[model samples]
Target: MVDQQWTGVRRRVVALGARADSGQVFGSLGHRWVLEDPLSAAELAELEAQTGARLPEDYRDFLTGVGAGGAGPAYGLFPVRRVQGRWRWEGDGAELADPSMLARPFPGHGPDPESLAALLAERPEEEDFDASEEFDDAVEAWDERWEAVMFAPERTAGAIVISHVGCAQREWLIVSGAHRGTIWSDCRADDTDLAPLVDDDGRPLTFAGWYTTWLEAAELTSRQ
Candidate 1:
């Protein structure tokens, strides 16, 4: 049986595409309002088997009911595909998600706050250096330390990159641990830690809630 959660989602998206001007929305041009094919039961099974983890219910249903990807928030949903019998998601920085580690629990927090603060305090400022070359070298070394703390692979375990909002900003869907099924924002590129995407009430957004909310907003924008 098709998952009822996604029953009218595809139709709604298609209808929006027909009327909505893509240019009106940011990152719409990436997908052009197109949806890729849904995954079959066998394919989904194969994917889960390979990854050693079951995807969150809402996202699993989305793969079977809606499309595997396309026409979503930001630059659209990253498409998952089987290449040479290996399932992987495709998009800018999508490879950051390690399929082998999907079963691990996601670390809800990034680096220690005190340590992060110290590192930020130590960030190199060009104006502090007399020579441009010295400043460049100092900044580059500082960036390495920043990336080490912010972009550590273990920080994102059990999550998948879902969407990109440009400038290296992306979003993740937690597939394991207590936060499973919720969406989280990735702004490490801007020297920020990952955070849960919350509703106006500050409740973490589940996969269904996140997508439906975006769909509703897109519909509203289209009608305007």
Candidate 2:
């Protein structure tokens, strides 16, 4: 069950979520996700179950009052914590919590070129996406929680960082090319990727495991 404090937040969310439009971007902590509609009670329950975290307050307020997805007409431009608090317009990312935050252009915080290159070498691709599918669907996409990427749990191994959000098998996240960063699914089953940290199969990976792979690859590459 979601916390009682979140009740007001949730109710406001349920009603407000229903009215949101697609591609509605909102965020905190320099991340983002497009709002679809006000998430239903069932949807909220489902999200909680999936991420193991509760949505935050301003998030509730935004979903219920202003709006969610892409960006709120009010807060969409600045979904930062202070915007909801004393600042109201300052848009502070650090003050916000997890779960409710959305993904956005959080420069200097994600993977770097050398690390990303090392990550790629550590976790090599096992299978290419089918010709029918767009090339960008291979990268893992995370939830509102800390650094995470969703992908298939089988057929992948070594050097990859992965976590299963248990998003339905049919859902696929596209992160490259023309359809870059678009979410999709086959409707047949869960998808998989070669996104560096998660091996060829899409299983959750440990930080140590990822680091070890990078170390080994760096050692080998150094010799060359």
Candidate 3:
């Protein structure tokens, strides 16, 4: 049974979700979305066991009470089964996160490059390489280290791809760790960097905040 509060939220969501398929919600941007059948309790449990990660409460509620797929921001919410295949990053080499790291908790804080700096300093120079080549080689080596830090479990860990916002931009829901339940934007994976989706107050939007905010916008826009 869905809780009273989220049941209300889900009702609003269902109303707004209908507009996604009609193309009125997004105003001819042509993004389409639809809600699928909700996942059975058994199915959700099986999904968690298979992935070794527990989902956040609100998202889990959405999946169980509302629908497992369809009718979401951007392209749409992916089915839970899609996680198995979406484990790898398609955007860039620097933001890689694999299936193995899904259960880990996301670190509350951002990247810590101090350890990476020390690790790089300990690496020995390449043997018999010319100055230019060696410099290039060293730079390449450092780049790898930098990428590692960016994608470290604390940085990119415990996150699952939730949806793609087109143009190679994507969204992830933090399933474990400190930021669990927060929605993150991966638009910068190939450019600037990953960022949390924030509200007008600059607070990172939790799953409920992100979705409800969109629903509110959709309602207001539809009225206009």
Candidate 4:
């Protein structure tokens, strides 16, 4: 049943390509979509092997059944082929430059709650510095370590950029760990941690859920 649903969405995605070929815009976001050319299954497998993680079934289906790249939320979907070489993280200093990191499991949770609370409690007080230089230095060292923990790789390990949501917002797909196949919104470009996309019921969205929503949105606009 789910396969049938995915097939329908794939058709919609294919239709977008047809429109693009005919020089027709499907929606406001249509201009942004560079409808993907189809990709071979062998190529998709190579990508999966290189990353050392199984791609989400829906996304795998999209790459082989729909298109290799292009046509998605925000700017457009990133092509797996183009992901080679170093990935420059624009928003923050953290970039998944190492492909080996993609093989690691993605962290299931965000920043640790207890650690965050502790850092908050340790806010340097003006009075603390006046007490002694030694105390101030100690406080500064503690603060630096706390900040590093806040942005540790565990926050978004085993994820790769799948799309650019414009304005430094990036959409990532988890490839490893328990969260594999989930879609996460990385607004760290806006100084925020990577967060999962949830439905009205607050359930974390899967790859299909995220991509299909964008496809449907484009279809609705095409009729307007």
TM-score of each: 0.97, 0.21, 0.69, 0.70
Query: How far in Å is the alpha carbon of 96 misplaced in model 4?
Result: 3.9
lDDT of 4 by residue, 120-196 (tens): 67766767665678677877887677657655666667887777666666788887888989888877544456789
lDDT per residue for candidate 1 within 1-224, as digits (tens), equals: 66797998988878777773746766788878888899999999999999998999999999989999998998899999999979999999899889888999998988889999999999988789999999999999999989887888899999999999899999999998889999999999899999999998999999889998988888777767
Candidate 1 Cα errors over 4 Å, as ranges: none
Residue 209 lDDT in model 1? 92
The per-model lDDT (C-alpha) reads: 0.90, 0.30, 0.67, 0.66
Model 2, 84-133: lDDT tens digits are 22211122221222222222111212334565455445442436546423
lDDT of 3 at 126: 59
- What TM-score does structure 2 among the candidates reach? 0.21
Q: Per-residue lDDT for 79 in model 4?
A: 64
Question: Candidate 4: where is the Cα deviation over 4 Å?
Answer: 1-11, 14-31, 82-97, 117-147
